[model samples]
Structure formats: structure tokens, C-alpha cells
Target: MPFIVHVLGFATFAQGTSEFMLSGLLPALAADLDVSLSEAGLLVSAFAVGMVIGAPLLTLATLGLPRRAALVGFQAVFVAGHAAAALVPHFGFLLAMRAVTGMAYAGFWALASVTAVSLVSADRRGKAMSVVVAGLSLSMILGVPAGTLLAQHADWRAAFWAVAATTALSATAVLLALPAGRDTTAARPGLRTELRSLAVPRLWRAYATTALTISATSAVFSYLGALLEDVTGIPERLVPVVLGLYGAGALAGLIVGGRTGDRAPFGVLLTGMGTVAVVAAALAPTAEIPAVVIPLVVLLAAGGFATNPAVNARVFGILGETRTLGGAMNIAAFNVGIAVAPWVSGLAIDAGPGPAGIGWVGAAFALAALANTLLDRHLTHRHRRTTSRSAPTAVDGARATTVSLYAGHDRPL
Candidate 1:
């Protein structure tokens, strides 16, 4: 990986910390603002909503800007939001600040994705992505936990201020480290032409697959702490330990998936999805068995995260000149997964399956993702076969033009 890739990952660590740190600070925030716990919880939801909308919208807004400048600009917004949130006493003001910070984070995600993919050669895109994914995983393991500790020792506002300071430093690193230019890997056509690239069904399928697989994982993950406490019978302090182990699996799986996903995208998808499905389904029946459930938690996180690099790499592979927009779309899809899955999991809990229901429900979603992957592979192979069978006819005038287009002289993303 390039040095700049690591810088991008480091920046991600700073921004991603704020993404999940709200969970740890919710109780304090509620008491400080004199609001209901449920109302304070909306602050997290506001961020998710910002992420979902900001990805595509902000990506497009900065479509024509220099990559480094856009990243720094987003970082500025992120820092400002955090600083404002830290000072603001009102719940509504803090909520708005959280949303603005989320938008900044999502925009940076979109730009950083395209930038990362562009930095590496085609074959190593997945490995490069793993570096960035490590930032996110590490945020779970290190950053959020650290923020929580800060909130414990000091104040929740201290945590917010910490994120602001870290984010500013990250932006400075980006300004110094990354080059001041747009992505040269893809041509910048007019806005309409760029939009046209997204019409490809293959790209949409890739995005849908991303959303579904992640949603499957989150359905289980969102309630994992509760399940560990209620069903697994683990001590309260040990719950974080198990969760930390799960976080370690994400970092560990980065190496496993990063090394292999470049050559075997489908293999990673199948194995990862299959592992998650099996582990999740088994968790329901074995919830009381600590020996089984503990390992399963680690496996679930590893299996789910292992697919992330491959998914991003596949998106870039399928994209045409609209790599920026496609990256944004996929980022939007990711936030969709994060936002929607918890709600689905909550439904399972409400319907009387209790915390154990998340496992089976997640299993079902994983299977659906697996099936989608199989079907996508089938269609892709069929298309390749059909195209090869008619390569001879591609030499004839109109056919030649169409063949050229299909082979990417002027293709869809």
C-alpha cells in the first residue's frame, strides 16, 4: 500500500470514532440535556440519516473539486460540527451537530474510497481497501473504547472535543500527504454522462449485495451486547472483553480477506457469508453455552467484515468513468445497511424471539445475501459465455461497435 493509503486509514480512524462513540455517551448526554433516553438516542439516528443522504449528495457536490481539497473541506466540516457539539448545551443543537458531522464523515468516505482504489493497481485494490477497513475496525476496537473511557474519566463533551482535535490533525495530514489533484483513473465527463454510468444493472446488483450482506451482519451485531448479557450469562465487565475479541476478529479478518479477495472475490463472499449464516443460526440454539457463543461472536464479526474489502473492490471493478459516483452510491448503501438492520433486529426482539431471535433473523438475511451472490455470479458467467460465443460476429460493422462498447470503450459503470 502507498504511504498515503495509511494516512487515509488514519484519517478514517479519527472520523469513524465519532460514528460509534455516541452509543457510549448516550446516558450521560440524556442526563445532561434533561431529555428522555429515547430522545437522546435519536442523536445516533440523526447521524445515520446524515450518512445515508450525505454519501451521494456530498460526493456529487464535490464531483468537480480536487480530491485533497474536498477531503480537507469535509474534515473542516467534521471538526466544526464536533467543536459545536462539544460546546452546545441544548439537545437539539447537539443533534444537528451530530448530523452535520455524519455528513462530513460520509463525504470523506466517498472521496477516500475513490482515492484509495485509484492509488493502487487493479489487482491489489482489495488489499488496499483492507488498510482502510482496518481503520474502521480499529475505531471499534481502539477509538470508540478510548472515547468511552474519556467520557467516563471526564465528560462526554471531552470526548467530542477529543474527536475534533484528532480530526483536525487528520485533515492536516491529508493536506500534506495526499496529492492536490482529481482522480485521473476515470475521465470526467459532463454531469449527465456521469449519471448515465450508474444505469448499469451489474453495478446496482453489486450495491444491493453490499447492502444486504452488511444488513445481515448488523441484524445480529446491533444487539450482540444485549444478547451477551441476557442469554450468554456473561458478567457485565466481561461483555466488553468478548466484544473486544469480536473487534479483534475484524482486524484479523482484514489480513485474511485482504490477501485473498483480490483473486477470489466470490470465494470471499461465499465463505464469509456462509460462515456468518452458520454461526448466527447456531447461536440461537447454543446461546446458553459460553464455549460455543463466545467463539461464534468472534466468527460472526470476522466472517462479516471479511467481505468488506472484496465488496468495495468489486464496485470499483464494475464502475466505468463514474467511479466517484459509484463509490458514493456504495457508501450510501453501506449506511443503509447500518441504519436499517438494527430496526429489523429490533422487530425480531419485539416479536418474542427475545435477544436470541437476532441470530436466526440474521441467518435468514445472510442466506438471502448468499443467494444473491450466487445469482449474480451466474448471470455474469452467462454473459461472458454468450459474449465469447459471438466474438466472431463482433467483427461486423454495427456488431463491432456494440462489442467495443460492451468491452468498455464506452460502457456503463
Candidate 2:
């Protein structure tokens, strides 16, 4: 199970590195392609749009398939997309290939979460999920910076080729590590039934919280390189190193965040969100102070990345029998935020580099996330109270054949 988890993590590591490395290489890509930076920025946006569109739809379409086959197939698609990106000469074709890559990313991310849960016993589910999510965090910490270094020394094409190679390696690892005929059909639920789960107020609140949190993080992160250059006057050669440091903070936060989630996910989330708000506000005024800037950036990255596992765990916990679909939707919410943030922040940057303006943008989004978190907590508390008050009478009237609400649903192992 640990080996299987590691293999899945490697695949996500490759995917995430490819997706985010674009930000660091935007200037190189524009220079090579003879396009404006804005045009190159579209490549990032295109991938996010693909994820937002593909996650839930593809998950639903491939429902009931063997998990191993689905995993392999999606990764194969990703390899093909990277191959296209590596070989394609035209800018238009490259953008199109990125969209295809995004679709594969959505499939992989959704399936990876569901598969991670299935691989573990009920008591180990949280650990399993964290191990998988840590892959993404590691990519941010290591893979993106490594890819950026590769792009710096070689051509941008080298980075894409490296991504393809990593995907192939990860695909091979997964094939060898996981057992044959591992079934996911038993975990499948009806689409309508899964959709109905979203109608629960608590569920929407969770989704809203996830969306706002992601939007808040991405609003700043999508432009982090630019922010470093423009605000802190960091040398271009140093941006990757700084970004790597940010990724390091994120990796550290992911580890600490998982342990924190086990104690109290909601409490952790509120605290993280509040911390982000304060960090963003502080960042706005301290860009010139490296002592202040570095720590603030670390805090912002740590707080934002830390919230991910807890939020995911909370949503899946509420999902009961529809954990797979629910997990996919949460991922969808995240990608939607990614898609929206760059375009919005890009507009802000294009308007003028006020430097501190980006921090304010980040701050505003964090405030919104804090609001949503509080709202979710309130609603969840009220729902629990109402359920406790009515439980006995409802139990007396229930049919004998009624399914256990939590039965067969993947829970923390």
C-alpha cells in the first residue's frame, strides 16, 4: 500500500510540476515563441480551464472502471499531452496541447484521491490521502524549481520533455507496484445520488470554502514570480530559488497541517485562514525588508497549503457514500479558482505594478475565505444540533432496510 501510494504521488508530482513550472518560465516561453507575455500567460489559464471542465465530467464518465486501468489511461493521456507540448513548434498548437494536458490532469487528480482512499483500511484513510496530497506539495517544493532550473539552462522544451519522462517513469512504477484487477466499481455510486449529496447545505458550504480558499491563494501565487521581481526587486536569477523556498514552506506546512487536521480540521482551517489574512496584509507593507518579506511569504504559503488536507478531509467526511464524486468536485472547485485568479490578477498587474496591490488582492480573497469558513462552521454546528434533537423520533420512524448513512463510504482508515 505504501509503494502504491508513492507511485501515485510521483505521478501527481510530475503533473503538478508541469502545470506550475509554466509560471516561472513565462518570460522564456514568450521570448522563444516571439509572443507577448500576456499571450504566454494564456497557457497557464488554458490548463486550469481544462481541469475545471474535465474533473467531474470525466470522473462520471469513467465511473465503475477498474481503478488501476483508469489511473493508467489518464496518465497515458498526460504523457501524450506532454509529448505534444515537447514537439509542437507553433504557439497555437502548444496552447491546444496544454488544454489536453489539463484534461488528463483532472482525470488523474480525481482518480488519485479516490484510489488512495481505497488502498487503505478505514483507519488509515487520512494518512493515505495525506501521502498522496504530499506528492503535490513536494512538486511545488522540488519539481517546479527543478524544472525551472532545467528551463534556465536548456530550452523551455527541455522542461516539457522532463515532465514527459517523469510521467513515463511514474506510470511504470504504478503498473509494477499496484496489484492487478483492483476493483473500484464497488466504490461507485449513481451520478444523480452523488449530485444530490451536493444539495446538503454543509456540502455547499464546504465547496464554497474550498473555492474561496483556492481563489485567495492563487490570486497571489499565480503572480508570485512577478511579485518577487517587481516588489522586492529580487534578481531574475534568484526568483527560482525564492520560489523554491516558498515551495519548501508549503511542504513543511503540508506535513504539519495533516497532523493538525487530525486534532481539529475546522479549527485548523479557521486559524490558517486568519493567519493568511494577517500575512497578506503584512506582506503589502514589508516587500523591501527581506527579513520581513521572506517570513511573510513563507507564512502565506504555509497557511494556504496547510488548509488543503483539512478541507479535503472535511468534505470527504461529509460525503458518506459518494466519496469519489465528492472528492472530484472539491478538486473541481480548486481548479476553478486557479482558472479565475490568474486572469483577474493579470488584469491588475497590467493596470500597473503598484507592487503592494497584489498583496491587497490576496488579502481581499483571504478575507472572503475567512467569512466562508465561519459560515460553514455555523451551519455545521446548527445541523448537528438539529440532527441530535430529532434523532430518536426519526430512528423510530425509519424503515428496517434503510442503508447505514456511513456504510461502504470510504472513511479515515
Candidate 3:
């Protein structure tokens, strides 16, 4: 509810726009730069690689800085990267620029989560974090579509220039809005500490759940446009509209997920993953039916995104004060899943399979995640019970004695 949240939202919007706008402009980039589509695709791949490296590295390096300052610095880097991309004529130069952008983007992305949590009481943390992340959904819904339109009407360079301008504006806004203070007490846990924490069975289970969920969703979403055309008989021009619907569904899910996360994170996660699996499977066979296709696509979008806030909350809660690093690591896990899913789905598609293969793959991933979630719940419950039973009773006895002394009347009420 703070004005700073708006600034963070806008910064996230700019980051998301820059990250996705390239997809729409890929053809223009390929034609103008005399490169293949594959080469153009490297722009995306390069960004992912940067994210894979940048998330943890930047979080670690900037561990001591104020969140506001870190965010501002990252946004500045993002603006510079986009500016370079707009001006660079060479494909290799553009790729490098995009990679730099990804690095900057990762820092901002991770910081945003930490900032959101730090700004609010523990009770509102999930909703606060969700509001910032909702910027991502907004980007998919509004930014990507608008950027694509800009590229179509003007040159693709226009899109990058627009994003650069947006990034600059967002950077200025964030710098002006967020309070200036450092959190020196927050953990400076090096990679060794982080690794040890991650080695915990419960944490690994969380990672597996996150990975599976992302793989399931990305496997289908990566090729959704093509799938719609082949299976749903949607025209190329209408694919964007359908995708927009999907984004809308995701936006709705984000809001709902945030509100529900506080009371029932695990429940939200379980229901969301289960719903995603069921919807994906159902949609597989009915892809030719427009009515079914449209609703199912929406369901898939909702189910996939609805789990995000809950997952983030759970992971951060598990890591406590070390959330920034943990959040970034979880983000890296999501990206890893994104990288793997498409390849897995592409192989199936290439083998003369239909879009249905995507559903099967997604379902399998969801089931794996579900299994992990159940195992995690069991372990957590067991741990709680064991701790309750094994904790020294003297501590409780001392508390009782202290209470009796304070009451003075000393008759056991």
C-alpha cells in the first residue's frame, strides 16, 4: 500500500518488458542483422545464462547494500543495457547487451522480493511480494503486446528504445521513492552457508517442487502460439489475443494467490498444482474445440501462476532472514526449469507428436511436484512433533514458575 510499491511495480514492469519484448522483435532483428532465427533466439538464451549467473552473484555481492540503492543501481544497469541494445548494429553486440541486461534484471528482480518483504509486516508479506510480482503479469499482459505493436508499426529498434526510456523512468522513480536505509544486520551468509541451508531436505523438496511446477508450465507456454494454431485452429493473428487471455487469467491468479497465501500457502500450492495438471490433461484431447480450448488455456494460465506467490512465501519463510539469497536461488531454479522444459517438449514435438505431448509432459511434472509437496508436508509435520516431544521440559517448568511468581497469589489458577 506504500507509494514505494508503485515505484517497485513500475521497475518490475520495465524489467519484464525488456525481457520479453525481444520475442516479438526477433524476426525484425534476424532480418536486419542478417542472422538466422536461431541466432536471434540467442538473445533470449544469453539473457537466461546471465540470469543463471547474476541472481546469486549479485545478491551475494550486494548483500550489504541498502535494498533501495541496489535496486536503483540495477535499474541503471538495465537502462544502459537497453540503450546499448538500441544503438548496437551488430548481433553479437546486441547479444552482449542483452546478457548485461539480464544481469541487471536479475539483481532488480531479487531485490524487489526482498524490498517487498522488508517494507511490510510479516502478515502482509505475501500480498506485498505479490503486488511487485504482479508487475510481471502486467508486463506479459500489457508490455509485450504493446511492444509487439510498436515493432509492427515502427522498426524493432523502436521497441528497445521505448523499453530503455521506461527503464530510465523506473530507475528515477525508484530512487526518488524508496526510503534510504541499509539492513546491515541481514545475513551476509556466503555461498557456503547458503549451500548448507539448501542441503536441508525440506529446502531441497521445496526446490524440487518449484522446479517441477515451472517445467510443467513453461513446457507448454514456450510453444503455446504454435500449439494454438496447430490444435485449436486459431489464426496467427488471433494467437496474440488468446495469449492475452492467458495473461489475464494469470493476473487474476496472482491476486487470488497473494490473498490466500497468508492463511494457507500449502493448500494454495497443492490446489494450484493439481488444477494445472488436470487442466493441462483435459485440454490435450480437446484442443480442436474452440470453446474447450479457450477455457482450458485460461485455466492453465490461472493454475500455473496461482502457485507462485504461495511458493515464494513458503520458500522465504523457510529461509527466514536469508530470504534474498534464497529467493534468487529459487528464481534460478525456475529458470533452469524453463530452459529444460522447452527442450523436452521440443523433442516430443519433433518426433511427430502433437501439442498433446505438452500436456502429458506438464502433467508428469505436476505429479512429481505434488509428490514432493506431500513428502515435504510429512517431513515438516514429523519435525514439529519430534521437536515438541524432545524439547527440554525444564524450559516449560521455568516459564510456569516465573508466571506463578508474577501472579504473586501462587495458588495454581
Candidate 4:
């Protein structure tokens, strides 16, 4: 509803483009730097590590500054990091630049949702947040492929330069668009309060749910290309086309999640996770069938990302006043899942199961998350009913008053 929403989305697109394009450019980077492929791959891990720690630590370090200022500052650093990567001569320096970019990106992610929600009414928070996330989906569909094409046609360094330039534009746009003021509404908690906020046990459950739900699907997705080629009997040339289908499904899921999340967050989460688990189960059995497996891949991607809006909305609901900290923690949780799940799946593949077994592993993760969600729902309902029964009611007060005025009230109307 607000123009600022698009501004934030543009910034998110710039960041997402920078993040996802690395995979496409990795080969060129490895060749140019005279490094092994594995070493180049570690650069991705290094970026994840930065996000895993930087999101919260940076938020804590800059807790008192106005959110808009923090946003602009982070984007500036992000632009600088990419520019350094573009110009750096050595592999190690480029790796350091990637880490810096990741840290800045994570800090911006941690605050951007909060800022978007702040700009709109409470009811539209999910919708606004989803638009921000769609930037990533669009990156997966367009930016990564385009960057790969650029690298193929010209040089990998050109991709980095393009991202750096885009980020600079986004930083300037954010500076001009968002209101320049401190968040006067949310109380800025002290260090101790922030620590206590992190201590909430229920919040961790929500985080676990978010992480596990993402891992369930990402495990399968991370290896979709290999699986399609080896297990599904699909030709190597068609893998990208199939992957594009998955991306489209993800976009659809994001749209559906955005619309329903504000109305029924838990319901949306349960449905999405359950659907993912079911699709994963179906995948293992039909891995050899191209027609079935192809459709299942789409469904799996949709099911996986469909949980995004609900996961975010539910965490914010649980954290209340500490949403900034909670949002940062949740983003960290998702990145942790992204970093861990694929490795675990690879272990499963090596243990005896073939490529097809990855789907089963994902199914197990989804089921575990589903069980946790059901448990949370049960506990919430039981607590509410218990509180209702024990609460002081109007009838109790009426009874107490009757005793005080019994003689006078003997004659009823």
C-alpha cells in the first residue's frame, strides 16, 4: 500500500541478487583465483556464517540508532563489499568481501521486515513481508540465471560489478524513501532486556519450527539438479527447465502464504508443512517416474516456501515487544537450516541410500516439524482452557455481592 514497501523490495532484490548469483559465478571465480572448487564453495559457507552470527550481533550493537539510519548504513556497507569483491585481486580478499556483504545483508534482512511492517497497518504485515521475500524468489528465477549468462558471455567480474552498481542504487533509494526518524513506538530494550527476550522458551520452539520446516524442503531442493539427472532419468539439458518450474512454484507459494498468514498463521503453517511432508513421501516412491517426480518437485518447492509468511508472523506474535531481536534470530535460524540440511542429506546419500533417499530425509524432517507444530497447538489450547476455567468471572462477583445485600434483595422483581 505504501511506496516505501517497493523501496524495501528493491533493496531486497539487490541483496538477493548478490547472494544467489554466487553459485552461478563460482566456477569462474575458482578459475580466476587459482583455487580449488571446494575452496570457492567455502566462500558460500563463509557468507552463511556471517549471517548466522551477524544478524543478531549487529542488531544488538546498533540497538539505539534509528532503524532507517541503520538500514542505509548496512546497504552502504553491502555495496562497498561487492565493489571490493569486484576489484579484489586475490581469492582470500574476495572471500573476506563476501563475508562482509553477508553480514550487512543479514543485518538489513533482520530489520527490513520490521521496517516494512512499521510502515503499514498491523493487518498488512504479512503481505508487506511477503513482498520483501518475493525479491529473493525473483532473484532465483531471474538474477542467478542472468548472472550466469553474463559470466558466460563476458567475465565473472562483470556480474560482481553489476551487483555492486545495483546495490548502490538501492542504498540511495532507501536513503531517499524511508522516513528518517527513530521508532518512537517500540521501546528500545536495554542489553539485559534483550538477553531476557532471547531467553523465552516458547520463542525457541517457534525458531525450531521455522528452521526444521525450511530444512525439510531445502534438503531435497539443494540436490534437485543431481537427483533429476541420475534418479529421475531426466536428461541433463532439461534440469534447468525443471528447476525453473520449482522456482515458479515457490513464487506461487509465497503469494498464497502472504494472503492467508495474517488471518490464520498457525493454520497456514500446519497446512504448508503437512503438504510438504506428504509430497516428500510421494517423491521417494516415484523418483524414477519423470512425470510424477517432475510435478512433485514443483509441489515440494511450493510447500517449502509457503511456510515463510506464517513462520515470520508467528514469531513476531510470540516475541511481541522483542520482534526486532526475534526477527533477527528467525532469519539466523533459516540460514542455519539452509547451511545444514543439504550436508545432512549428502551424508544420507553416502550412507547407503541413493540420490532418491534425499526425499525421504526431507520427509522425516517435515514430519518432525509437523509433530512439533501439533504439540504446540495442543499445549496452547490446553493452556487457554485452563486459564478460562480458573479466571474470576462476573458470576463470582455477583455471588459475592448477593451475600452482602441478601436481606434487602429477598424481594425479587
How many clashes show up per model?
0, 5, 0, 0
Global lDDT of each model?
0.78, 0.76, 0.73, 0.75
lDDT of 4 by residue, 306-353 (tens): 888877766766665556777789888887776666667767767777
Top lDDT: which candidate number?
A: 1
Per-residue error at 100 for model 4, in Å? 2.8
- For the record, the alpha-carbon RMSD of candidate 1 to the native fold, in angstroms, is 4.1
User: What global local distance difference test value does model 1 have?
Assistant: 0.78
Instruction: Give per-residue lDDT, candidate 2, residue 365.
Output: 81
Lowest lDDT 10-residue stretch of candidate 1: 404-413
Residues 41-74 of candidate 2: C-alpha lDDT, one tens digit per residue: 7888888888887888889888867777788888
TM-scores of all models? 0.87, 0.91, 0.85, 0.83
3 against 4, candidate with superior TM-score: 3
lDDT of 3 at 295: 83
Considering summed lDDT, which 10 consecutive residues are worst modelled in model 4? 404-413
Candidate 3 per-residue lDDT over residues 190-234, each given as its tens digit: 566765666555666777777887777776765665577667787
Give the range where candidate 2 is weakest over 10 consecutive residues by summed lDDT.
404-413
lDDT of 4: 0.75
